[model samples]
Target: MMMTGSALTDEAAEAETLVHSTKTDKPRRIAILSYRSTPHVGGQGIYLDYLSRALVERGHDVDIISGPPYPEVDERVKVIEIPSLDLYAQPHNGHFALRPRHFKRGEDLYEYFAHLTGKFAEPLTFGERLKRYFAEQKPQYDVIIDNQTLTPGLLSDALQKTPIIGIIHHPITQDRQLALDAEKSFRKRLLIRRWYGFIAPQIKVACQMPIHITSSGAIKKDIMREFGLKSEQLRVIPLGVAQEDFHPRDDVKREPLQIITTASADVPLKGLIYLLRAVAKLRDDLPDLKLKVIGKLREGATSKELEALSISDMVSFESGLTREELARAFCAASIAVTPSLYEGFGLPCAEAMSCGTPVLTTDGGALPEVVGDAGLVVPKADPEALATALRTFFKQSDELKAELGRRAFERAQLTFNWSRIAPVYETVIEEAIAR
Candidate 1:
């Protein structure tokens, strides 16, 4: 039974797909918990989207139990939406404030009052809702993955029996500290502290979890230091990028002197201020250079910095872009940069790399780990260093830039592909289930 060449090729392709797939020998029921999943914003939502898709591809039944701004996932992945006050989306005036119906539930009352007093209570309220939902639904699962919502409700008696894997995406304490460091007024700092009060419960819950996961060793250390977790309880699994959505667009021509980056919030951790400073310094060197920020320009320190630097005209921002649109933006840029002061996994850096765009990121948190030797790295929070690196990068010949882009794409494919990373996660899940 000798097969023709095309038939043999088809057989080989089938074998390759099987080998590369994350399919498991025994399929299990899995539930992923996320408090807030803002779609495409590249935090909890992006994590849920890719993980659930990969798990379903691997022959697992996955249910994403999430709060408002529910994640967009594969058709095979069931999404169980848990409603929240979502106060941030609502007006805080007394007229639109608490209603008689809100008083029906203590959680709702607390959420309304907490937000009224300038405290961020979504995490706590979300946890309450999650616990109630679990009790009512009584959904059975082989394992549960908590996506950084280290709320005390997760430890309720109903869920205590199941094997729950908690993932701390870089301790929220880092976010708290960064916010505190960015503000000078004592009153503002106090408010920031109050806003981050959930950290206390998060730390408490994290210590009780049997197993925890983080995206990088850098973040694992931070979690260990911040949450008082031992090394044995933690596993480092690198996050995955959507290869199909983020790959290079050969049809799009890269524009010289055009730089692109993703900085959703104008926070100190994002280090956008430093990038703005670097861009200001490079204005004379590269007169026509343009910076494309994939985020909104809100009224904050970043806006002030842009005005102070007088480079607001040269800088433009775009938000709410589709995955394909973002990929095209990455492909059209000369290079992508992530100047974050710290990142748990540096997903944007990986996304840019997947688009075949050479990256220039800081040695912040896991940015160096994500970049590896594929692109360039500069000292975090150093605008002069960024300027120097950009100068050097711009000096490289077109051939060199193309080679760098190729290396970045290759590294992303090898290191951050979901098909490869999902199996690692599956092993962790299976281990927890066995325990």
Candidate 2:
């Protein structure tokens, strides 16, 4: 069938009109700077990966000017690789070669040695690199979204004129204080404090920057308390999940009674010790209960607590999975737990609920703030309360658990989906740019 000449002309006119219409509003140009984006590592990388993708999906031209182990972003989004001393390597799987990649110069070698001596060097070097990026590219992005690098490098003497908005996921000072509380010897405490000294600049920059965004009100308060910023100085935007991707699977066989937690080990702020003890206390009643951990467990007081409670046999560790795998695990488990002593925002709590699994979280930091009245909440650092919550869920019939899970799913759908979050981010970016 052949189209008429008028139909073809009409199509051409519509195409031209659409093109001209789009040309009127300049597509937002964004520059996101991150020190590292190692897939298996920290929350900074995940924040960079998702937020940039969301921006690009909404017709924004985004660029991630990142250091080593670049983020997994949409191929359409430009990723400008900016190299620096990538010390504190996270033992890349199946390849533990100690060979250096970029430490050719004396300065690079010195930086690597500095990291070996428990000093953090990436944020400092990455800051220097940001200056060069602006000097050469000279790309005037609408706004520079710094992914909590908090390095003075972004605010360097040369680049001070450039408008940059700092994103502090949570105050690193909080992490430092928790580490001090968890330390054994005075030397360990000193070394831990020294390592966190990198955060001092972050606190300074977050305070000085004209605009600041954090993940939660809890974190906003912490940042203000730690850095002494005014209420108006901080903007609290909650983190979100991809609702379509996180729904539960009804067919996946439940493991008698299984519980899931992400990044559960190593970080004292996560409060894994209390969870382990809770599990230990319940092992007699719910003998089939299992813990599926989705992060590398650091051998600290948390691990020692597990040993002391003799709950090590019931715990299983899994790490380095893509977001899809994480969602599947969320479905495969019965309940999701976030035992953090503090969270900027409890992302896993929302993510699991989005997957249609009810969450049991601590009333620490932002967990209760994010979880609201939907999921079970208990006091921080209390094994007895955690055990009671776990016991209630275990004894409840599937019909009840399913009902609570449905409410959780609705809460996540209405509140914390990425579609809901990205527009708020856009508003913040525009506000900063206008200034």
The candidate scoring highest on TM-score is 1
> What's the TM-score of each model vs. the native?
0.93, 0.88
lDDT string for model 1 (311-404, tens) is: 9988999999988998999999999989899898778889999999999988777777777778888888999988888888898999999999
Q: Which ten residues in a row have the lowest lDDT in candidate 1?
A: 1-10
- TM-score of model number 1: 0.93
Per-residue alpha-carbon lDDT of model 2 for 1-435, expressed as tens digits?
A: 111011112221222232222221446888888888865676667777778878887789999989997888778778889866454444642123234654555445645666766767678778777777778767777778888888887766556665788887777777888889978899988889777768877777777888888766666767788888887776666677766677777676655499999873487898887888889899889898999989876666667777788888899888877788898898888999888898887777888989888788887777766776678888888888889888988888999888878878887886676776777777677778778
Report how far residue 171 has shifted in candidate 1, in Å.
0.9
**Candidate 2 backbone clash number:** 2
Superposed model 1: Cα runs more than 4 Å off: 1-23, 93-95
Give the best candidate by lDDT: 1
